[model samples]
Target: MNDTREDMANRVFLISGGTSGVGKAIATGLARLGAKVVIISRSADRGQAAVKEISEATGNSRVDWFAADLSLQSSIQEVANIYKRKYDQLHVLINASGAVYFKKELTAEGIDRMFAVNVLSHYLLTNRLLDILQESGPARVITVSGHPRFLKNPVINFDDIQMEYQYSAMRAISQSLFARTLFAFELANRLEGTGVTSNAFHPGRVKSNLGRNAPWYLRVATPLVNAFFKAECGIGVYLASAQEIEYANGMFFDEKKRIIAIHTQFEDGAGNRLWTLCEKLTSD
Candidate 1:
């Protein structure tokens, strides 16, 4: 932790979805350690609020914000371009931006809203910033993933990648999470020996605004569930600052510690397919 803290000072971090929830916590923790934090958000008002809160809370005025609709590839590319123009290097890139839709819908881009926000945005943004991350050497990429028990096989439906044919609240959320996990692992594989490490984690059921899209009953139950089972921002602090897992790549964690994903398919050949699909989707 000491080493991580010492190394973090003066370094740059770009965190998507840092406006609230676990992402906000991580941004605040890193800023306290003296890192130059750049938070990307869809709304300027929310972004400014988060930047002010983080700066005041940590007493680190280096915190800044970028506004972009991550659900759109063009917006993500623009944000990346702005980041590159402002900062010469990025020491860490945290893909913490995610969302769940109570009902199936498509974005203005004609892509499923869930897939666009939860999976595609991270995919496009990470790839766009890969060069600077590699140039920064010893950089880290941490993705916030979810843990959902599924009743059916969690395979990518190439025929209808965005759940256009069939959709349910749970199924839509599950699909995006599965895609995110695969992208994290696939990213690790591609970044091997590049001094860039990629990993994903389940932030452990925090009482965050990520669930605002849930039904009325569940939204009402959020406080109770969090009271009994939610985890603190400490786990996020550990993952970002702990020295032991600095070199750890292609791994999935429950919280602070590394844990194996029960299904072997998570590490199987599915990643290649997903990667290929992502490449095709994001290609010009």
Candidate 2:
């Protein structure tokens, strides 16, 4: 399908973390282009509010939302099942759901918080919906990844991926981002002939709630940092809607322009190992 804004009209878009920040911004922009958008959030009230606000702002009443924690495998599975039951097609999937913890935490499933939401949820949900996306054809999957600068080594540490022994908030978050990038590349490779494009992008630093759980100093400095350097939600809108990048698969982007990060391009063997590990971890 062509990338014209009018083409997006009636197209089905599903987004996670669309209640606020970059996710919400992307949802609003797509809704403005007349797409039928369904957002998933942890809070029903927040989800409803976001749907109403986006609908009112875009003058498109097709906006709706579902409630899901997204931090548990069961929740992710149930959400995907509900979506599949209602929608037969998914033209675009924007995975903007992410979180950073000030300290190491585990979900009800006993998985690391960073790994569960930022990494595992993206893997499971996208995989579950792959059939619909493939059937729809010419679909796009855009996952919001972290900046390359945050990852120094970008190793998966198969010995202790969840960092049960040497856990640190920063390290856990960084590894999750790297895993996300790795999964994006691996997904692109697997979906090569499926007419589905999978890519990852760094939205730059934005003043959002992603840091709400971080140190007080970071919370104080987030606004100042954003004032000096930050990418607005429009960057996400462009990647999700621009026709020029319809075939740009397996690439990473910063500020709407594709750039190669050396760390993310690990040996093919490493990527395959990571993919296998993810499959095992997310398996029922």
List, residue by residue over 125-228, the lDDT tens digit for candidate 1: 99999999999878889888776344135767766778777787776777787888878888898899999998888776665786688889878887776676
Model 1: lDDT to the true structure: 0.81
- Alpha carbon lDDT at 190, candidate 2: 90
lDDT of 1 at 53: 89
Which candidate tops lDDT?
A: 2
Q: RMSD of each candidate? A: 2.6, 2.7
Candidate 1: pairs in clash: none
lDDT of 2 at 273: 79
User: What is the alpha-carbon lDDT of model 2 when measured against the actual structure?
Assistant: 0.83
List the candidate 1 regions with Cα displacement exceeding 4 Å: 1-4, 148-153, 226-231, 261-263
**Residue-by-residue lDDT tens digits, candidate 2, 47-105:** 99999898888788898888889898898889989999999999888999999887888
Task: List where candidate 2 sits over 4 angstroms from the true fold.
Answer: 1-4, 222-231, 261-264
